[model samples]
Target: MWAELIQEVRVAQTGVQILFGFLLTVVFQPKYGRLADTDQAIYIVTVVMGACATGALVGPVSLHRLVSGHRVKPRAVRLASRMTLVGLALLLATMTSSLLLILRVATHDGYVPYLVTAVVAWYVLCWYALPLWARRRNRGGSGD
Candidate 1:
């Protein structure tokens, strides 16, 4: 379970790190200074969320390294799993905010919020709903 969790974290960590790195560069862009106050605020929030998501996704490796000699694999796995879940949720927020900022800057259409909301719903369905449904459905079977 620990190995599996680490493998999963590796995938998430790569994505969040890439996103955070990109977010770090946006402040240096020429258009950054021209953004509206509200848009700047959104950008700040998105970057912060990206940073946090990156940290959370990378936390498992750090946790393992620091506690390597200890006999706490089970507890560590539980904690790391929780951290990964939080990281994923933060990643979702970061992506949503990033999209919102991009859409707000690209076009001032009134339907942007609706479009973002729909995308969020789709993410929730894919990231959480389906997995949860499958977990519940298979709870009584031998899969566990």
Candidate 2:
């Protein structure tokens, strides 16, 4: 379970790191100064969330390194799993906010909120709903 969790964290960490890096650069872009106050606020929130997601996703590695030989593998794994889940939730928020900012800046359409809402629903379905459904369905199945 520890190995599997680390593998999963690696994938999420890569994605969040890339996103946080990109968010860092966005502030240096000239167009950033032209953004409205509300848009800038959203950008700030998105960047902060991306940073947090990156930290959470990367936490398992640090946890493992610090706790190696501490005889706390089970406890460490449980904590790391919780961090990963929080990271994923933060990632979802970052992506949603980033999408909202992009759509608002690109189209300036009233439908942007609706579109963002739909995309959030899709993310929730893909990220949370299906896995939970499968877990519940297999609760009484074979040990495999």
Best by TM-score: 2
User: Positional deviation of 94 in candidate 1, in angstroms?
Assistant: 0.4
TM-score of each: 0.97, 0.97
Candidate 1: segments with Cα more than 4 A from true spot: none
Q: Could you give candidate 2's per-residue lDDT for residues 51-126 as a string of tens digits?
A: 8999899999999999999999999999999999999999999999999999999998799999999999999999
**Which whole-number lDDT from 0 to 100 does residue 103 have in model 1?**
97
Worst 10 residues of 1 by lDDT: 135-144
Candidate 2 displacement at residue 8 in angstroms? 0.4
For candidate 2, the clash count comes to: 0
| Per-model root-mean-square deviation over C-alphas | 0.9, 0.9
